[model samples]
Structures are given as structure tokens and as C-alpha cells.
Target: MDAKSSATDAKPAAVDAKTAAAVAAAEAAGPSTGESVRIDSWIWSVRLVKTRSIGATACRGGHVRVNGERVKPAYAVRVGDEVRLRHEGRERVVVVKRLIRKRVGAPVAVQCYIDNSPPPPPRETVAAAGIRDRGTGRPTKRDRREMERLRGLGAGPGGPSGGGFAAQGRPGDRDPSGGRGRPNGR
Candidate 1:
């Protein structure tokens, strides 16, 4: 009964070698969405968005790009490749670290992607004409009523109900579609 030998023999030498080889292979591939990662899955794995659907939505919405051109979810992102993402009102650039096809943990997500470029300078922003920001921060009850009073969204196709689009509906509740009213505009 050799204690050291017994422990050593618990695992087959071949199994140990196989495990070591698998780990080495995974490490060689770098970070990925999972054991095997696709570009879209990898992006989802990296804490970029809350879900894979959001990542795909961003891509379909022209918010995701490879280099300078918009790419679809099927795009194969690899190490060193650049990815541009438009989130909220800002654009972010990231580099691929590894490809993982499955969802990953937060820490693992960080390893799957890299930041390659900084967002654009804010000074160059140009607010679209006719539309103006009433204010920032959460809207108070009074503020909501005031915004409704000064509704500024463009009008639906034909003329607005009583006034024009900007004049008739509330600022954030413009009825773009003919169906429904302001809040529930279809």
C-alpha cells in the first residue's frame, strides 16, 4: 500500500495527458464565447450586451461593424480584428481576443474581447434641427406635463389632429403610425 503511488494511480496517465492537452488547446485559442465561439456568440459572451438577441439586434440595426463596414451576426470575428458597436448614443470599438460559441461568465467575457479604439469626441456632435432637449435626468410629473404641452416630435403622415405633429402629440409619444394615439402609436 504505497500512499503516493495509490494517489498517482487514481487517475490514468492517459486521462491526465488528455486533460492537459485539452486545456492547452483552449488556452491557445484564447478567450471565446465558450469552448467553441462564433463571432456573434463571442460578442454576446463578452459583457457587451445583456443577451445574444441584443447583439444580433445591434448588428441588424447597423450598430455593429467590422473595420468600417456594417456586418451581420454571421460575421466571423477573430483575434486582432476590429469591431465597432453603437450603444445608447455612443460608439465603442473592440478587438477580438478569442472565439466562443457559447455564453460565458462576466470574467470570461472580458477575455473574449478587447477595446481597440476610444469613442468619438463629443464636441463634434450636431443635434438635429427642430428637435431640442427640454432637459436631462428623469422627468418629474410636472416636467412630463410641460413636455406634453410643448410636444416636439414630427407629426404623423397627414396633418396632426388639432395642430401639426410637433404641436399635437407629446414630445416622446408621437403617433408615428396612423393607428393608435400618441402613447400607443402603432
Candidate 2:
């Protein structure tokens, strides 16, 4: 091998070892706040939604927490940790099964961790969620009547709520009916 190529390869190999050691040291530093994970990356990896940015927003909005304590994106999660969260209205609980460092599909994310999402909220809570009956098995006649009432009282053309109640776009889509929105706005 040429001397220049040999020297270049040798340098990178040493750098790799140094990087690995640094990582090990960092891991051993111990989280003063207890078991935690990167709020943004882990949420993305867990398929909780779709992207890191969304996860970060969730953390900021108080939707994600570690061991009952709200955490920021910098939190470092460890195994067997418990996390509390709220998506729409009802609270959820999740137990970390493993540490995931990379983004994964929804199915794979499910396999990576254990989520103890709270059972379906009471009928009243469901009604307050604004969204139509979710996983409510089958809508009974009474629910149908309430839905009709809600629709009639709504401001939207057919009875839909404001923009806040609308569905969110996925990670990389564009917003519709707007000049400015998120990438997943579509």
C-alpha cells in the first residue's frame, strides 16, 4: 500500500476507537435525574408519531414524561423506565423495554417497547375528545344523537370544529388550504 493511503487509514481507525471510548464514558456518567431517553429521538424511533420534530414538540407541550416527571429532548432514557404521556386528552403510560437509537416503522417500534396506554376513557371523556367515537366498538343510538347535536352546533359547514380539531399531517407531508404550515401539513 502507498504510504499516504496507509497513513490516512490508520488515522481514521484511531479516531473511531477514540469516539467509541468517549461514548462509553458518557454512558457511564450516570443520569443524575434517573433513567431517561432522548425525548425526540426515542419518540420517533418508537413510532409514537413519525418524526423527531414532532416528538420534541410533544415533550415541549408536556405530552411526554419520564417516571412521572416531564422531560425535555435531552433526557436520556434507560431500560425499564416508565413514561407518562397524553396525546389528545386521555393519559397514557409506557414502559421502556429496550433502548432504540434509530428511527423505525410503526410495527417495529411496537416491538421495541411496551406501551400501557390507558384503557378507553369513560363515555363522557370520549364525547369531549371532539373526534368521533374512537375504538368505541360500535356507536349506539344515543351517541349518534349527541353527534348530530354537536354537528348542528359546530361552526364549520357540516359541524366540524376549528383547525385545532383537524387531523395532523404526517412527518413529511405539506399543509393543505394554507400558505404556511408544517411539512406534514398535507
Candidate 3:
């Protein structure tokens, strides 16, 4: 009885191992040839876009190109195509290395494409914008003036005419000429 029970257990274990191996092999092989995936689906699957819908939206918005030509979302993508996507103020250029139709982990997604994108532009060092330190009392009159001056809203050496919103005047301030028409009269 013990021998028979062990044989049964061994058979199931062997089958499980075989199944796992087959799945792994499929993943390693990637999508088979003759099976095409949509451009949007491919981009989303490979982590080029946040979501499949966003990929489609980018395609419709003319932000995605394949091999230097604009393509629609449903366009078929094959291996070895150059894909250029303009997204979020930068362009991502990649060559398709593998074809996948489902979103995968970051590690796996990266293997699907060879990134040829240019180095991103260096971030400009901008001064902190009006962030007051915590627990500081309200700005004094001088501090207020200084803040306004830094923001180009203060009266400069040339007074309010120094090219900024200050010269535009408050929305409620009426024209001194008592008319709202353009100076040259349309």
C-alpha cells in the first residue's frame, strides 16, 4: 500500500514539474512569429506607456511613430521595428527586440525592446518658488515687497512700466484714459 501511494504522489509531482517547465519554455520563447500585436498593445505590454488606453490615446494624438512614420493604435508591430514615442516632454526611441502582448514585470518588459533614446535633458536648477519656512511669522512689509520684486510684480526703477503683470494692473483697475478700448482704436 505504501509503495502504491508513493507512486501516485510521484506521478503528480512529475506532471507538475513538466507543466511548469513548459510554461517557462513558452515565456523564454516569447510570442511566436506569425502572431502580430497592435502597436498600442505592444507599447503598453513593454511598459512604454502607463496603460493600454494611454498608449492608444498617444497613438491617436500623433505622438507615436513607427519607422519614422505615424501609425495608428491598431497598426501591427513586428520584430525589428524602430518605435519613437513623444511622451511627457521627452522622446523615447526603441527598437523592438521581442514581441509581447501582455504587460509584464519591469525586468521582462525591458528585454522586449532595445532603448536607443537620447540622454534626457539636464534639469535646470531653479530657485525655490516662494516656499516659506515653517513657523516663520507672516512676511513683513519689506519681505512682501522683496517677494513681489522677485516675482516681477513690484515697481522697478522704471516704475510699473517695467514689463510684467504689474503693468497690466489689477483686473478691477480701470484705464486711466476712462475707456477700455485699445490705444490705437481698432
Estimate the TM-score of every prediction.
0.47, 0.46, 0.61
Q: lDDT scores for all predictions?
A: 0.66, 0.67, 0.83
Worst 10 residues of 2 by lDDT: 156-165
Count clashing residue pairs per candidate.
8, 10, 0
Task: List CA RMSD, all candidates.
Answer: 14.7, 20.2, 10.3
Q: Where is model 3 more than 4 Å wrong at Cα?
A: 1-31, 124-128, 134-186
lDDT value, candidate 3, whole model: 0.83
Model 1 lDDT tens row, 2-90? 99887778768766676556545545555534333455566776767768888888888999988778988877776777888887677
In candidate 1 the C-alpha lDDT for residue 146 amounts to: 56
State which candidate, 1 or 2, has the greater TM-score.
1
Ranking by lDDT: 3, 2, 1
TM-score of 2: 0.46
Better-scoring candidate (TM-score), 2 or 3: 3
